[model samples]
Target: MILPKNNYLKARNFILTNARMIERRLFEFHFENGTSEGVFHAVYAYRNSDGGFGHGMEPDTASPESQPLFGIMALETLDEVGYLTKEIILKDFMPYFKSITTEKGGIPWMFRPKSEYPCEEHFKTVKEWAAISTTAPLLGILEKYEIDIPWMKKAEQFVWSEFERIKEKHVFCYLCVSRWLTFLEHTKSQDKAKKTINNLKNWISNNGIICEDKTDEGWGLYGKPHGLNYAPSTKSILFSLFSKMTMESDIKELISRQKDDGRWDTWYGISEGTKLEWAGIQTLWVLKVLNNYGRIQY
Candidate 1:
């Protein structure tokens, strides 16, 4: 038998082993039994800190605390391992999902006792790129759990409308581009989806390998990079993998960047006075994309 050979196997093993290090505290409610907790812990942790995952919004790490998005990473890992379940997902994870929503019907990037960030930014009042990026993954999770939110239908409508509004413009950043495309694809808006795809292709062609614009780099939102704009993580890879917009050479180049051990270098901000590796969540996301495309072997 020809076993699948590539860096993906090594990456898969690395992820599997590191997954054990995930902090159980964040997931106390979900994993009470042998049931899978979904990605809630990872999601909550990442949002609680910077708006993105990885280590301190800088380098990549494997520990759960070190890796803020560990919940989502864990969920992806469970899916890859074929251990995800519906009951545990619904009972434990869905409650938090409801909490992320604002009274205005917009989802914030993170929740704090008093306020939320990026309250003013987004395509429409209903669809914030950061919010939708965080929420889109839950749609699949929700389906499995049989938890229905009528607002989700409204959110879907908002997403479709936003796609039409933005398809003609230059698309930038991984989350906005990826989530927009994912939403369009999932909702079956083939024409709008294609337009979104083409927009990404146009961006890649004009911007070259690395997107350098301040907006694309996650600047100008709060006059800083913030957590959402860090580079070389799931958001970046997702834009490349799912949109059907990137060139083959670009795709190959991205794949080539994967280390023999299955991790990608952190290309975003480096936190001062710290040396933590911070790309685990981003790396896992890229791995998921590769797996989805059948580029990685089981």
Candidate 2:
């Protein structure tokens, strides 16, 4: 079954009314024959002078200064619109990433915001350690584009070493593990990446990370990840990891969870504006995934 045309129109109206400019452009680009250049212009407005992104690029913080988390979000935005180019990666993203990278050659989960703007409490808890959560997905995106930079080499080494260290312990957060899955899917180190994926597949299945059942109403919300969280597209490497039944059930749940206003609810955020912003982002994400899975009628 596919999402009805009326439902898609409702979502379009909701986004035009309530979403941020970035998300609105993304929605149009993906579904309404919007140009890549249009989306690129919207994304470029968030870039700081230091070549990083901030000023609420992520909607999680109002900080104007550059942050690692926002950098990743920027990359994701460009990737989604197919505007992630080598020029941008090297001249813009790489320099910023190098500036903020930890001594271990990986980006930290976040840094304390210098601005007085409101942000989530977790953003205040500074961790003085390199995080594979951020680094792995960055590497994965680089790998997907076949962009081989010297800095990326070091970051890849850091990611591989971290995987070796964490192999013994099957414990991992869904967010971090999700990034690792992306890395494994794209990294040239096929032998090692495959071995790690085999080892972690069961852990991903058994861990409280994925919402495997369709009847679980609270699956995607409240910071919980679901099947689409891990495998947003049929082409994702994580796609083959799940059974057909499991994937279908989660897709059904996703389709059924749209609110009356034609948006999905976001569970984590500080201000009401942040909540609405994330709702717009989440609604676009859901529609994109549904489209990729052939569940949306054009």
Candidate 3:
């Protein structure tokens, strides 16, 4: 597994130079042989006054108020770095989600924050709905940690029931489907995992239209569907069916896409004032995936 060392260095340096302290420390823990203690502090630093995550750790939104979803984001990041089973992620966060959860037992996909919170403008206006994106990954985190919390059981049932209903016909949202793939990677329901990925692929065949930019047969695509960075290619639409997501082109593109200073750019940065944060996240995300797959060693 050959890595683009120079580019990897540049990406790491970009995180150090551009990211907030929490993100910066966490980046170090992943790339620089830094301490798990650093990860713990960094993960907790984003905890808002109300005990859930806020202050922008999620990167997509900039809410200062505590958000239930962001708590999962924080825990997921910690999970990425091997900080498993922190009570902070569950005890405090479960209540937040439970409060905002729909009657159907799913968290509102878009929990709109109060206007005063620093946020991405797009999130402020997003329509709320129950979604696999909100519930599925969180369940994956709980299952991975083997945490037997009561609320998680309810959420899991909700997610499975929803997927069962859509087993035959569904609209694939690249946004949620990508995360759903992550959940499936860690889920216990192996049979359901098989069924769900197939449904996702079928959704593409049904709804996808020809687009110059989209990969994966031009379905399940969003953002720069044509750009190499955003394109999933033929391998990606049904990528959920496979455990590993990298292709040779994915490695090459990961190398090629790094900016001169080392950060990866994102579509979010184009419209949001928080480009630095999102790009930092993008860089870290690309590095994590590449590193995990043995495409990059740095």
Deviation from native of the Cα of residue 47 in model 3, angstroms: 1.2
Best by TM-score: 2
In the range 1-298, model 1's lDDT, one tens digit per residue, is: 1114556566555555443234222222222332334444443344334233433222222222222123344444455335566764554444555555555443444322122312112211333223444455455444444556686775555555545555535254544444444345454446766766676566544554343342343221212222123222344433444234433333454566666666554543234212113344445555544543445554
State, as a TM-score between 0 and 1, how close model 2 is to the true structure.
Answer: 0.91
Candidate 3: minimum summed lDDT over ten consecutive residues — where?
218-227
Which stretches of candidate 1 lie above 4 Å from their native place? Answer: 1-81, 112-130, 140-147, 164-170, 188-263, 268-276, 279-298
TM-score of each: 0.49, 0.91, 0.77
* Model 2 lDDT per residue over 195-232, tens place: 88887776667766565554655677544667677678
In model 3, pairs of residues that clash are: 213-225, 213-226, 214-225, 216-233
After superposing candidate 3, which stretches have Cα over 4 Å from the reference?
1-3, 86-89, 164-175, 182-188, 201-246, 270-273
Local distance difference test scores for all models: 0.42, 0.80, 0.65
TM-score of decoy 1: 0.49
Cand. 2 Cα-lDDT: 0.80
What candidate 2 gets wrong by more than 4 Å, as runs, is 167-175, 212-217
